[model samples]
Target: MKKTAFTFLSVIVVMTMFLAACGNSTKPSNEGKQGSTGNVNQEAPKETEQPKQEEVKLRVFSTFGGTDAAREAFAGALDAFQKANPHIKIENDVMSANDDGFRTKVNTDMTSGNEPDLLFYFIGADANEMINAGKVVALDELLDADQEWKNGFAPAALNFARHTDGKIYSIPMTGFYEGLFVNKALFEQHGVELPTDWEKLKTAVKTFSEKGIIPLSGPFDQSHYLIEHFVLAAAGAEGQNKGLVDGIEPNWEKGLAAMKELYELGAFPQDAATIDLSMAGNYYSEGLAAMILEGSWAIGGWKDETKANTTVLPFPAIPGGAGTGKDVVGGFGTGFYMSTATYENAQKKDATVLLLKHLTSQDTIKAIATANGGTPAAQGVEPDGLPQAALDGFKMVGEAVSISMPIDSKVTPETFNTIRANIQPILTGEKTPAEGLGAAREIELANKK
Candidate 1:
């Protein structure tokens, strides 16, 4: 009986030990399955993950919109840049070059700390305020750092764009020439001679007015071209360059007087006092007017027929003035300016600079010059498909006795604004020639003080 009981106990102990070992082996197998599944889950996301690119945005301000000749070309260039860099975005802010309000807007934005990343503006006095306030950065070092970009520009163009302090703050895209753009068809139809001199101009104006055709299409309110040409014609390059800084030049007064003489002969549009430059351009473009005192940039915006029939000439010297009748208002006057804010922004600096370089590249300059008829600032780049009028303008510039920057460049913006404001009053006999010029001189003096 005792042996049988002991045998039963041994059998129970062996069964219990076998069951415990089986349980331990099963637990390890289940844990191994879980560990392998966890490893697979961890490796799956790593295999499919991609790095995300952060997008950048930039704003560029310029006079490349609102019927400007190079509007489409400018848009196309921006499109190309955007395509090349999908990670970057651009906001093209534009205003008409003819709009006086644009100047005010730019000045206000720059001074009020709302400046754009890129600014297309005049290089001389027009930029002085921003430059003096340190709103823009000098690009001399940047240009020097990029050999290809620096070498692409015409040396003369770069030199011409230098500020008074001998540093380049702007990168020139194209140079411009302001002249008398004439529709030869109109002159020929009326049996009037081309306005090669003051007397011929008077004759053409008298004839066109009598025949019910607008003689010279220009706005008294926005009389920029008229003022520029008349002042250049009367004052000549040297006197015009003297500005109102040393008081008003007698020749400047004579220039205003010449404008009055033309006004008396109905040389301007009937609605000249109320019209803006764009309206005045429309008159000439639609063939309602015979001539327009405008810049090379105006050529491409004219009607096809008018453009084909057009020719450019220097404004003739006013009688008894200092002008040689060959002096011209032209040169690399305007360019792209980089704001100090943009240059200092670590996030935007590189991309903004890249955009600037692309815009001012040789190919881009050629494209813009082709559209606007402005002289290309890129070295060895001649624009294709130039109109005869543009070719004539180039020839005229080549033959000019002296090519001077516009009068506004030689004076302060406030002084030029004063001059522009007085154009209508001066034309209507409300202000004498001396009075108009004297007012501008006062503003200039106050600004200088």
Candidate 2:
């Protein structure tokens, strides 16, 4: 997990991004119903009153569970919905957003005809598979029926989730921004300047290592994302997207070399290959590491102590690269999807739509954004009450020349897997950057059809 926004010819560019690739790897719960509804009391139906309509169970499957920043916001919204519409019982099936298996589990459920009445999932090309499989319901009618609600979202945000059919299938919750989370105290303590270019980054690595601190903490074993970010910085948005559908571009090899160069300088954690992403974040939060490459959504995870000294900055620029340190790897990836089963049923449809409305309304979206340090997908979102670091991240996103899509979103699942598996060897010095990326490119080109 992330899609494209810059259109070239007939292509409808859309951008998408994913949470970190580490979490509890448990399979989606197959226990059927998510949770029981609270009891509702009813006075004996008076002869004058028709029997109360039977309770409608609205099943919702979400990948926003666990300790995700948006989890509390999501839960709060659901609680508010349940209180408002007691007749519609909400059964929530929550999966870890960081779990790579979540998407597969959802696809399996869809194929097995166990689709939830509502799905909280990715938009863009990732959602296209379900749309083509006829498992997704177009939301044009829903939007038309509630134009007032539709007007609340940014038109660009809506376009990010719209499929090739020119109809929206998902309601994007919040947009995201990716960059370096710098520990200001660490840099100050080590007497090293913050990195704004590759040379400064190297100087930091040398200085931090002498003090037994990890210069940068990241999951190098699952670092296709890091490579994506680097390549975007090296090539800019247009250059990175140019060779995606064809073959690997020169900038990709150059970008891989750049990362390998850093690894050779011991820039990353010693256990970068083995550490889980959450553990890496912990290292940074606890002051054991100087910096981490992370997205805006991860801002809330840092402890208040760390947040007090934290500041966000665009990724350091590469020498002779096209990037101005303004392009970012981010956009809308996770969002809400309503199933055809829910849309077609007259009984459940109304309540289900209402629930969706509540979950994605401006208030709810703002809550999620503020909690996660993310940009609200809906327009006119004021940055009131957000952490100063988050506000800084937002400013970078606003000034970005072009927002890049995550590599996983741009390639086939198989190709993405190939990249993830092969890139680690380069970091470990077992494979040359050229060799590692070459193998990945072959897989991408072979399976591109």
Output the number of the TM-score-best candidate: 1
User: Which 10 consecutive positions of candidate 2 have the poorest summed lDDT?
Assistant: 8-17
Q: State each candidate's clash count.
A: 0, 9
What tens digits encode model 2's per-residue C-alpha lDDT throughout 1-449? 12233421101111211111224232222121223343336554467455566799988999778668778888888888888667789888898766677879888988888889999987755676788888879888888876767876766677667676788888987877788889998898778999877788889988887788898888876675587777887877776766455666777777777887887777888888787667888898888899988888777888888888888877866777776777777767678898887788999887887788888776777788878877666555543467778867766665666676676766666666776776678777788766876777787677655
lDDT of each: 0.84, 0.73
Q: In model 1, which residue pairs have backbone atoms overlapping below 3 Å?
A: none
> What's the lDDT of the predicted structure labeled candidate 1?
0.84
lDDT, candidate 1, 1-449, per-residue tens: 01133332332232233122233221111111211234555556766654554787999999998999999999998988888777779999999888778899999999999999999999888999899999999999999987767876766678778888999999999888889999999999889999999999999999999999999999987878888989889988778878877778899899999999989999988899899999999999999999999999999998899999999999999989999888877778889999999999998888888888889977788799999988778665667788899888877876677777887887888888889999999999999988988898898889898
- Name model 2 segments beyond 4 Å from true: 1-50
Q: State the lDDT at 113 in candidate 2.
A: 83
